[model samples]
Target: MNGEGKVVCVTGASGYIASWIVKLLLLRGYTVNATVRDPNDKKKTDHLLALEGAKERLKLFKANLLEEGSFEHAIDGCDAVFHTASPVTLTVVADPQAELIDPAVKGTINILKTCTKVSFVKRVIVTSSISTVMFPRSPLGPTDLVDETTFSDPSLCEEKKLWYVLSKTLAEDAAWRFANANEIDLIVMNPGLVIGPILQPTLNFSVDVIVNFINGKNFFNRRYHRFVDVRDVALAHIKALETPSANGRYIIEGPIVTTNDVEKVLREFFPDLCNDDKREDIDMITKTYKLSVEKVKSLGIEFTPTETSLRDTVLSLKEKCLI
Candidate 1:
């Protein structure tokens, strides 16, 4: 077995993407230590316990991102650690420092601190967002291509009040600084606006982007939807860990679609769910910069098509009664 006898710890294992990572880890025959805010919250964890190998191989630990030494129990005996816990609000937050920044930056530092104390740990993979790379200081031209090399401007993020982006940018920055100073092998997975079927009952921010359109909310104007399936993102994390030469950051993204493109696909497959009146506000000709995925593709990921992802998303939403 690929993961036989190997133990891994995934922080925020009950989240939108981390849940899938836990599921994938279990299926690979790995012993998994999953950390969440409240391990006994059945509403947040029932789906995780029901996974294929959960009963035998999965253990849930309670952890607080802001509290020091909270992650020690979960990460102590693990071979690798996946740090995926971070606030992901896309809307205006009442307290950016407490609600967004502290948890993200402090949580990362705490995890790395714990990782340093443990000798058995070999690698740490952090889940970051393309926002840290794509949100440049200046406006990007339509022909511009974004890759792993670009870092988002912290000052610019603060200027625009992009709290979520700023949080991710700063957190990833903290992770790299800690990893480098401690000589810990670190790999970062930067995924773009993740969307796919939901395993957790509650709707996440990324999934809400699709739900907004179904509910007749015209949230898009000059925006582009850079999407990657949740499953693919999970798989990418494992691939990064398993691959010997996998180093630095990988931008895990797929087809870049615009508001017009989104409306066209939704209308074609989900005509009843889409409101035609709301789509009139969409700007078809506004182009967005493309993301470079060649680095991630080197790991042999053939990304799921955009239409397939959208169809599966709607089907899952309907099944969950969330649409």
Candidate 2:
């Protein structure tokens, strides 16, 4: 289960979290097979190649999640697979099951099925969201802190929303079921709103949040779930892969802050871009949801502080000319 000499394949390697995972794996001296939709997309893989030690240890493979057995070649001879590829769209799609549910569930099943074919594949680390575990129950209690055991109720999934949460829940459920049935080692990392700097600013979804905030698009002052740094989430993935004792679900939660907190940070850091006075009309909806990291911490993982995360994210946006 050690990653020093082992080869690990990461799905959606060019993605926000997966890209960081790929970099960390390379830095740890693990050979990384990064799967992208197109290997010819220089814009995607170029940033990954630019990382230290990536030139020699990193390999890019063309793969699609919907295509059955496409991941077989990428996962061949690999000791572990990090399945972080899943559709995450804020707007409600016409067919939630088609766009989110089926892809997430089927893609996870496909990857694990491929893992069953490879004897060397001992561990399968899945990137699940806290949305899968939190936000399902109706009346939020004051002390409701979501933990690893909590799951989003399927009955609560509605039309205008619930698609994303439903997708993650079903996808994770399928992974656990397939792993147990096939006897594959399954480890899931459930991360809250992933923030922090982007390795490739242009290709990351987290960066889009920063861009939207800077552009004053997030005028809604609703309080949401806590945020976790993408770097920390990446580290958690590496730890989950290396730590053989790590199993089940681990909740990666950071400081629980509201949209006002984000605006305050932006106003303090980049006052020129953010109008402090314009936030008066912002409506803040506080939802009682806190993810317990005690389980993940038991695995010897330490998360970065919230201030550090926000500062790093702001600095990264400025560097990318997004603010």
Candidate 3:
């Protein structure tokens, strides 16, 4: 497919990862038709508008996750569509299903329906979470290798109250079903907890985990988290778009860092701000889980170092006064 002057659409254009994908696409000379819930909201669209080459190549459209046919206009004339819109909140809301399920599963199907109508679309990349593959109820040991074939049992997710995990698993399942039924090319990316610098003013859910750690909250539940820089995830999307042989699902985890590893980085970055008194007593033997990177690595994607990713993320938080 031609990259020059190609039109591409991205849902949730204002989101953390989606914003980076848009930045990369615009830099690569692709005309981006980006969708947000409200195009009139200056806070969401401002960063996107200021992106390089956005003046001539970017177009913003208002689209709702629950609204059918809302994303039709945005993705209609595109060669590829990146569906990155999903609820990232981890807290147990009053209406967990509505807050997580409907928007993720139903919204994915809505985009696929629109893409089916748009004849120009050659590829559809859906942003699924690593939660879809990892068994949150029983995390794997350090040596365990999680790949595309592994899936979080949906029943297990429901029984274990893993709403966010359930949302992604269901959404990706529905997308694959729709793609198969319509004979469309679909590639799903299950990225582990995404980290890195902020292109937006507010903090995302993934970054908020780090913030919460600094706040000395939820330490009793401390465990290892696999992080993939958002920029690398965006590049993987581009790689999948370009690789004709790429199919099925791909795990996008970069490095696995334990909670103690995280605290060490925090202390190193901000000694004064991080209160030792408030810090949680990290376990001597932290349980760690790992994701297999063989699939995405086959496409030649290199990830940012764990230490560098953490340092830059904290520095960026400090720069934005979020720390």
Question: Which digits, one per residue and each the tens of the lDDT, describe model 2 over residues 152-220?
Answer: 776676543778888998899889888898899999999877888887747355556656777776623
Write candidate 3's Cα lDDT for 1-323 as tens digits: 24677999999999999999999998888999999998999989999999999999999999998999999889888999999999987777788788999999999999999999989999999999888887744656777767898888888888878788888988988898899999989999989878898887789988887787778654336555567888889999988998899999999987657666777787786574443333443532234544579999888899898777788888888998998
Tens-place lDDT digits, model 1, residues 1-323 = 58999999999999999999999999999999999999889998999999999999999999999999999999999999999999899887999999999999999999999999999899999999988897778777678888888999999999989899999999999999999999999999999889999999989998898888777665554446667999999999999889989999999987767666777777765677554343343443234565689999998788999888888898889899997
The CA lDDT of each predicted structure is 0.88, 0.81, 0.85
Ranking by TM-score: 1, 3, 2
Weakest 10 consecutive residues of candidate 1 by summed lDDT: 278-287
Every model's Cα RMSD, please? 2.1, 2.6, 2.7
Q: State how far residue 45 of model 1 sits from its true place (Å).
A: 0.8
TM-score for each of the candidates: 0.95, 0.91, 0.92
The superposed Cα distance between candidate 3 and the true structure at residue 315, in angstroms, equals: 2.1
Clashes of 2: 0
